[model samples]
Target chain A: MKLMDKLQILADSAKYDVSCSSSGSSRSNRPGGVGNASLPGICHSWADDGRCISLLKVLFTNVCIYDCKYCVNRSSNDVRRASFTPDELCELTIQFYRRNYIEGLFLSSAVIRSPDYTMELMIKALRKLRHEYRFNGYIHIKSIPGADMRLVHEAGSLADRMSINIELPSVSGLKLLAPQKDPASILEPMGYVRERIMESRELVLYKKPQPFVPAGQSTQLIVGATRDSDLKILTLTEHLYRRYQLKRVYYSAYVPVNDDRNLPSVNTSPPLLREHRIYQADWLLRFYGFKAGELLDEGHPNLDTHLDPKCDWALRHLDQFPVEINKAPLEMLLRVPGIGYRMAAKIIRARRVGPLGFEDLKRMRVVLKRARYFITCNGRYYGGIDLDSGLLYQLLSDKTDSKVMAGQISMFG
Target chain B: MVYVTDGSFEGILTAVFEAFRNREDPEEITLGGDFQLSMTAGIREISTDTEKSDRVWRGVESKISKESLENLYMAYLSEHPRVGLYIYRYIKLGLNIGRKVEGYLQHPDVHAIYDLSRRVGSEAHLFLGILRFKKLRNGVFYACYEPDNNITQLITDHFASRLSDQAWIIHDRKRDILALFNGEEVIFTSGFPGIDHEDCEGEYEELWKRYFSAIAIESRKNPRLQRSFMPRRYWRHLPEKQL
Candidate 1:
């Protein structure tokens, strides 16, 4: 098949795995080399899906032996199958890199013949790019579930980031949908990679440094595919972060591509809002000091569709309202719904010079509409509605109007 | 005193130098051509002097931070007509209060200049991702972008370090300036028409477009969100946007 033909089929197959971040590693462009990785990743383009196109994400091939029901490349599916030769892959990547079309490559694949076989081919392409062509751009490769740990190690040394998709949120979901796959196969490689990454850092001074995925590791979860509650998902996310030290846990709104009885129907639209809310909660977990138990409990198993997780949490705890803006600490300032970590830090910095008034907050570009309710600027409560009034909830709720709500749905959904 | 400058970054710094030396407070510092006729009677024209500018630049570095110096230069690069006056006032304030000038957000003058500097820096940062380079027929990569602000110089180091092995040219078509880097050095040329040598396109463009469309999930198409990130104003030169 033609190179362009293979690119289309492979990229189409890989579109559903939506972790395209190219950040965290600063790979130097070697002398007489072609490219380098910037510390903060740059998004080359925004796809029509509204996702950032940071990498040239593609599968090495779409031909699979195991039939995972949620995947587009399931073995029973009669989709057009194609694969790129290692040489063709290298040629495509170099041309694209020099043209500034992508940061680097995100190489994934279906189980092509065997797990180790697929990994070896991926390592060959990566070696050619890094060694032969002297390409030093950011690469995020997928570790095949049952690939040899040695092969995974070889590939890890050459790439900047590596990820394994824990597609289902629960073991029950995996058993129901993909009985061929076991959770141990996925987590074992992840555990091994985590160990190696930690070991690389520990032996940094004593031994010749081995750069094993300098950008760290990430994982993805398929939201809304199974009957996983938000509490379950967020709990699992917190566990993954604490246990595996995962850099990111991307939640892909499960796009129903297959007609499996166990999965959602093909006509069902992906639960993008849920995915977005999970991301917000994930950020809170990572940046803001919010625990999963604080965000959700057994009583409230799902995030409110009308209110963001932060606002929902704030509404539930009204005694914390009217936080004194100037006197409040960074932790308290971040608890306000509209005030992000950036705004919180800015407040901390600016207030060190002079006390910030409501006017000053507005001038600093604070999202006062939402923040005013939760904060008192210089001891003046600007939020007209009483904190306990039901009207406060009405104002804070996102469903202000049908038109604007529709726009938000389209934007996030 | 109303001062007129040559409208370059150095010209603004020289105005700061002359202001300190002559001990005159500048009310409005306009560019040579931008000065209003009503203010022509007592206007003092400041020439670009590298020695004088460098002295003020070093003073800023010693008294404040290197970050503050970059901020001042970035604000000047905004090419605002009142930017010179803003810098003069900012320097007057910075000299006395030292590094605290950056934190005085309550002061309108300080806030206005810092805001402009921030916008310029952000534009420069955004162009790091948005700028596209096409391979020229002569084997050098060529790109032209119409950024909202002058940022070609700001983005030069990023592309230089990344594409060091290849020669490339970045053209700020909006400002009629070309930043040509021949793998070793960077040269800035201005007042030139925005036509370039032939681009060896077609194959790369087609392949990129195909990949772009194929990668977008049909169920998740949101053009408005796409526009919010990659604005329509920058779509004129992007290959995938053309398709």
Candidate 2:
């Protein structure tokens, strides 16, 4: 196939893997090199939904050996197959970089002939870009399941970031849908890479050789594909963070592309709202010092559709109401529904200057519409009867029109 | 009555400190030409004072965090004429509660400032990577930029260090600011020369245009998404946009 033809097919197939962030890495243009990745912010081409489209996100080949039901490029699907040579990809990336079209490459492939074969080809493509072409921009490569751990680490060293998609949340779901793939194959390489990175860091602590995987590792979980609850998904994400030291666990709301007996055949669009809520919960866990168990358990497996997880949790824990405005700690203030990290920091800073009154809270730009019910000013609560469940619900419903609700549910927004 | 200064960041910051001490009408603290033309009005030509300027600088610094101070600095570089007035208003809004300026992402006035700042900041950053230099006959490296934001001033330090040994002139064609480096010292002023834009086009430019065309995956072309990232307003200077 022509190079452009291959690009179209491969990029189309690769669009489903949506963890396309190019931020957080720091690489500058070499003496004669063409491109550089910024440290504080990445030069990303954002889609309408506000997701960054930085890399020339493409696959080496779309022809797969395994039939993962939720995947668009599964073996049985009637999609076109195209492959590119390493030189072709490198030339494309360099040319694109010169034109200010892209920052780098996000290259992945299906198991073309074997897991080792596919991985080796992927590594060759990246090595060609790095060593031969001297392209020093950001590169994110996918670790093939069941690929050799050594090969995974080799790819990890060359690329800025690496990701291994869990594909499905549960073992039984993987068994039912993609029997050829196993959780151990995915996590084993992840575990190996994790250890190698740790060892490299330990070596570098003594000012030795700078080590592997500088940008860390991330994983993706397919939401709404199986009957896995949000609670189960988050619990697994918590374990991945705590146990594997995973940098990010992206939740892609499943969009069924192939008709398969093992997968749930939903007639509606993917639960993008639920996936958004999961990201909010993920942020709370990562940055806001909340735990997975605090949000959900067996009883409330799914997040509430009407309210955000933070708001829902706040509503349920009504006994903690009217947290003193000036006296409450930063963490407690962050737990409130309307308050974000910025607002919490602002509240902390403002209170250090003087005792805060109700009017002062509004001047500080707190969302008093929601914070009023949850906060007390100088031990005086003006939120009497308004904090009642039925009345609060009515007020919230009245205030949150459909458009504002849509904006709240959107992760990109 | 208070006097409004010309719409420069230094001018606005000077007016802010002037309003801070003046016990006259506070609402008169606005941009240029807001005075009522009465004898009671005290119009002051606020020359750029680096000392009182640094004091207003300290106020912005002590009031908000470091990141916010940088953002306000960039926002003050926006192309909007009334941006000085808006920034003055924003700082007054911040004075009531020191951290109120920190939430620049949401508050309408602060968001307006932040949007301009982010545009200028990102453009300055993009120029660091994208701006190309050409060698003139006089051994001077000349580069022209038509930035949507007034980011030409931010490129001086970048070019100064990167091309330290070379004599160069970076002209912001739109804003009429020239950053001239004489291989020893750098100078900033407002003098932009006209150039025959068509005469400068050549093979490397053609090659760049070719690469841009070939890179787009035709089957997945979304012009809306493309426009969102590199807005059409910036395309006037880009070689690919000329194609």
Candidate 3:
């Protein structure tokens, strides 16, 4: 098919993948390549979900042999099918790059003939972009489950990053939804790639060859598809970080794109807000010293729909509140519901010079509304109006909404 | 007495330097009223001089980090209140702190500059993505934008290298500046004189608008969020806005 037709079809299909980030890579242009990737901020394209749009995420072909229940491109589903020749895809990317339409390409494919065939096609596309077209822009390739180990290795060398979607949190869930794929098929390639990246990092002193994935590996887990608890999902995410040294664990709120007797009805949109909360919690876990158990449990397996996970946790663990602003450690300050890493850094810097009182905290742009009730700096407390739970909720509700009010103040603060 | 510029970021930065050299406060300066009247006591126009500008740029570079330098560039792009004067005083204040103030990335002045920079940076990034090109009969390519901040200066180099094979004109209609790139070189000009408004064939624009509308999922129509990303002020120049 023509490249634009393929782009329209595959980008539409691949929009549901929801891990379209081109951040965190620092690859520069080679001698004859068309582009480069900036570290601090590169270009990204936003999906319908309003997340940062970075990658030109698209599938090579929507034609598949496997009938994954949630995918619109499954074999059983009657959908328009398109595929790109390596040259066509490379030319389209270079044109788009020249026009500033995209930063990098996030190329994935459904199983066309076999796992190895699909993997080889993807690798060939990347190699064409790299060697034939001399396009050095960031390329994120999807690692096909059950692909040959050697093909996966070649994919890493050509691409900046590779992701193999775990699809489901558990083996039973995987079997129920995507019976054609199994756990080992996905995990094995990821394990091999992870080990290679680690080995390359270690050998950097003695040897100069960097492995296939410089941005390292990332994977996606479908949220709200199975009855998996938030706790279970977070635990799996934590393990992915611990075991695989994965760079990111993306949670795609499951949107049923195909009809199946076993799958949930496609009437309801994915709980996007819930997915957003999970991401917030995920950020906290990765950057803010948060544990999985701290945010969820067996009984309360779901996050509160109204309040954010951190705020929910803060209310549940109120004793940890009213943390003395002048004395609390950086970790504890970061745990405060309103305080993020940026705010915490500000507090640390401000406190270094002198003692910070309520006024100083206010001047430093702390959300004194929510924070005042939770902090006592030098015996001054300007929060918790009436100290009644009902009143506190009302006061907190007004103050906690920093989104709209963030504009009233200098957003730089 | 001090004189304020017209709230344009460059005007503010120019005034800031004037205030510091004359040992005056920015708050006392007003754009065309009492301050200008008082300044008539014996004032001079700060002509845009290359050496003076380069020296000021050097002061900004030495006093602040590269990030802050970019921030100052963005701050200069804004049409905010006292922005020019604030930038001028900011540089002088930055110089006095020796170097410790450079780490004060959260200072209100720093934050303001940072915010402006992000807005300009975001617009530059978006123009890279959403910018649509047209083939004029003259064989010149053209794209028009109404960016939230004056970012036409920022995106020229990107377009220059990317479209080296073709001559292109990127016009920031809101700022009345055009980055014109011939096949060989690029220059920032005030305006395009020969281009006809009716030359908009409107077919490609219609197709782009249709594609935009089709791609926007109704299931996730968060206009609030969309507004947060692409503000309505820029809607006037957007092809989708014509619809």
DockQ for candidate 3: 0.23
Docking quality tier of model 2:
incorrect
Greater-lDDT candidate between 1 and 3: 1
Which sequence of candidate numbers ranks them by lDDT, best first?
A: 1, 2, 3
lDDT of 3 by residue, A54-133 (tens): 56677888889998888888898889998888887787676555545567788999889999999999888888888887
CA displacement after TM-score superposition, residue A236 of candidate 1 (Å): 0.5
Give per-residue lDDT, candidate 1, residue A112. Answer: 90
Query: Which TM-score does chain B of candidate 2 obtain?
Result: 0.75
Q: After superposition, how far is residue A296 of candidate 2 from its true place, in Å?
A: 1.1
Error of 3 at A208 (Å): 4.4
Ranked candidates (DockQ, high to low): 1, 3, 2
Q: Best-fitting candidate, measured by TM-score?
A: 1
Q: Lowest summed-lDDT stretch of 10 residues in model 3 chain A?
A: A404-413
lDDT of 2 at B89: 71
Count of backbone collisions within predicted model 1: 0
lDDT of 3 at B169: 88
Q: Candidate 3's error at A106, in angstroms?
A: 1.6
The positional error of residue B47 in candidate 3, measured at the CA in angstroms, is 5.5
Candidate DockQ scores, in order: 0.62, 0.17, 0.23
